[model samples]
Target: MNVEKFKKDHNEILALVAELRTITQAGIAKNADAIAQQIRTMSSVIKLHLAAEDRVLYPALAKSQNPAVAKVGERFQQEMGGIAAAYMEFAGKWTIGSKVSSNPEGFKEEANNLFKALHERIQKENQELYPLADQI
Candidate 1:
C-alpha cells in the first residue's frame, strides 16, 4: 500500500547509475576513487531496498487472494536471487578502485550490463509490482 520508499530507492538507483556512467566514461583510471565510492553507495542502497522488499513488499503480495498476484511476487523474488548474486560478485571483484582501474574497459562493460539489468528490473517493479501493491 505504501510504496514511497521503494520509489525513492528506485530514483536513487537511477541517479547513481547515471553518475556511474558519466564518471566511468570520463575515465576509470582518473576517476577510480569516485567510481569506487559510487559503487559502494549503490551497493548499500540496493541491499537495503532488496531487504525491504523481502520483508514487506513480497509478503504483502503473497497475501493477495489473487493467484496472479501471488505468482508475480514469487517470480520477482526468485529472479532477484540471480541479480543479487551477480551484483555481489561484481561488487567483490571491484571492491578496490585499483581493480577497476586495472581494467577500465572491462569494468565499464560489466557495469553497463549489470546496470542495464538492474534498470530493467526497477522499471518492471515500478510499472507492474507497485501498481499491484496499490490495487491490493
Candidate 2:
C-alpha cells in the first residue's frame, strides 16, 4: 500500500476541519452564510476521502483472515457509517434547497460537535485504523 497517498487525504481533511473551526468560532449569528458555505465544501471533501478509504484501505484489511485486521477494519467501517450519516444530515439540513437551518444558534452548536467528531475520527484512523492495516 502506498501509505503516502493516505496522508494527502489526511491533510485535506485537516484543512476542512480548520475551515470549520474558523466558521464555528465566528459565531453563527455573524457567519451563518459563511458557515453554510464551509459545510458544503467540507461535505464534498469528506465524501471523496471516505470513498478513497473504501476503495483502497478498508477493502484490503477487511478481506484479510487475520483476526486483528478484520476487527479493526470492521470497527472503522461501522463507525464511519454513522459519521457519514450525521455529516450528510447536517450538510443537507443546513445547505440544501431552503439553505441554512431555522435556528442559527442550534446549527452552530451542531457544527461545533461535528467538527470535534471529525477531528477525533481522523485521529483514530491515523493512529489505529491505518496503522493496524499496515501491520496486517
10 residues in a row with least lDDT, candidate 2: 96-105
Predicted candidate 1 versus true structure: per-residue lDDT over 30-134, tens digit per residue? 998889888998899989999999999999999999999999999999998999899988987876888888998888889888988999999999999899888
Weakest 10 consecutive residues, lDDT, candidate 1?
92-101
Q: Write the per-residue lDDT of candidate 2 for residues 1-136, one digit (tens) a residue.
A: 5556777788887897787677767766566677778778878888888898888888888888788788889889989999989988888888742344358767767877886897899889888877777775
- Tell me the spans in candidate 1 whose CA falls farther than 4 Å from its real position: none
Question: Which pairs clash (backbone N, Cα, C closer than 3 Å) in model 1?
Answer: none
The per-model lDDT (C-alpha) reads 0.90, 0.78
Evaluate model 1: give its TM-score. Answer: 0.96
* Residue pairs of candidate 2 with colliding backbone atoms: none
Model 2 C-alpha lDDT versus the unseen true structure: 0.78
- Candidate 2 stretches greater than 4 Å from native: 96-102
